[model samples]
Target: MISMNCFELFIQTYFTQLQVLDISRACAGEYINGFRWEQLISTSIQHLRIFALQISFKTNDPLMRENTIQQFQSPFWQEKQWFFICSSYSIMFDSYINLYSINPYRKKYYLLGNENTTEIDSMPFVVQLDIQCENV
Candidate 1:
């Protein structure tokens, strides 16, 4: 059984990987100084069965948002079973949140949402993925 702390660590690592991918994709056309992390992930972490990607951008411009969406929907990455979660609020302020997951062999994305937002002061979103491998 995975401990609570270990699970938290796993989530953090997943978030980090997603951030790196987003940054790389956004700057793909530009002359970047660093190598892509996707190559490293493909070489290492062979046992990884699930990937979660989350992208957050703080901007009021519509064109920037469109560009960000385009980068995420690019075909440079292989196609796999994907799960996407999106939430946005445009009331007093504007905010958008999205999370994505890919798993080759199983459905793993989990959704947890709160029932009441009246008492809460902010929007909350959750995406969870479970991955397990069995030896044949």
Candidate 2:
């Protein structure tokens, strides 16, 4: 599990590129590296509400399967957008992502593999997330 301090630093660093309001916390000219951590977190929270993320992981190995689910449920991944890009600094996971949803009460996950297919294929030992939640 990632410690709170680590998570905070992760958030701070990940959001350093964000374009904040041109006010007291702006990082560029007329500002003094004034970006604040709270602002970065707020931006991330907003992104969570508005964006759909594409996440992928291999699960051929039993141990990896367990890790995938655990990572999915971690605090860093609770936000859907982060989960889509959290595995590695790779862009391939962003391809061919189709929106999907889950039923928490049923503990069931649904995937859209191909638009023309009617049958559910056997689990391919790979999990991909293209989840989209309504902005609230």
Candidate 3:
């Protein structure tokens, strides 16, 4: 098994060729801050892949989520496989509200103009933007 840092590196280097990748605790705190990361992977003695990256704090912040989505939803990232997982409890709360409101019985009582409800509806757009950024 490789160390966390090295695993992150390997993912970056060979992400395109990889059919599967699992990462944990590699980018915890630093995930919110901008940083550079690299990865190298070898599929065989003669086959190697390398990827170098400078991560931007462009999409991780809640305040900038809408803007980030607008920027990344362009024609870029159309062909890459990407995933993003957010640990923000507040976002999860918003998602829960969204789900609750979606129930036919609940929708009748919830105010149509509620801000939190609106934000919950917008979460999928925000997530799609993050994915586009990673893939792009």
lDDT of 3: 0.26
Model 1 CA RMSD to the hidden true structure, in angstroms: 13.7
* Candidate 3 local lDDT, 1-136, one digit each (tens): 2334654553444333332222212223333221222112222111212111222332244644343333323332122222222222344334210000011111112122212333332221111010111221
Q: Report the C-alpha displacement of residue 59, candidate 1, in angstroms.
A: 2.2
What TM-score, to 2 decimals, does candidate 1 have?
Answer: 0.34
For model 2, how does the per-residue alpha-carbon lDDT over 30-90 read when each residue is reduced to its tens digit?
1111123234446543333322223333223334333333433445445443332223222
Ranked by TM-score, the better of candidates 1 and 2 is 1
The better-scoring model by lDDT among 1 and 3 is 1
| Candidate numbers sorted by lDDT from highest down | 1, 2, 3
Better of 1 and 2 by lDDT: 1
* Better by TM-score, candidate 3 or 2: 3
- Locate the minimum summed-lDDT window of 10 residues in model 3: 96-105
Error of 3 at 71 (Å): 6.0
Error of model 3, residue 12, in angstroms: 5.3
lDDT (Cα, tens digit) per residue for candidate 1, span 44-76: 333333445543434455554445444444342
In angstroms, the error of model 2 at 120 is: 37
List the pairs of residues colliding in candidate 3: 9-39, 13-51
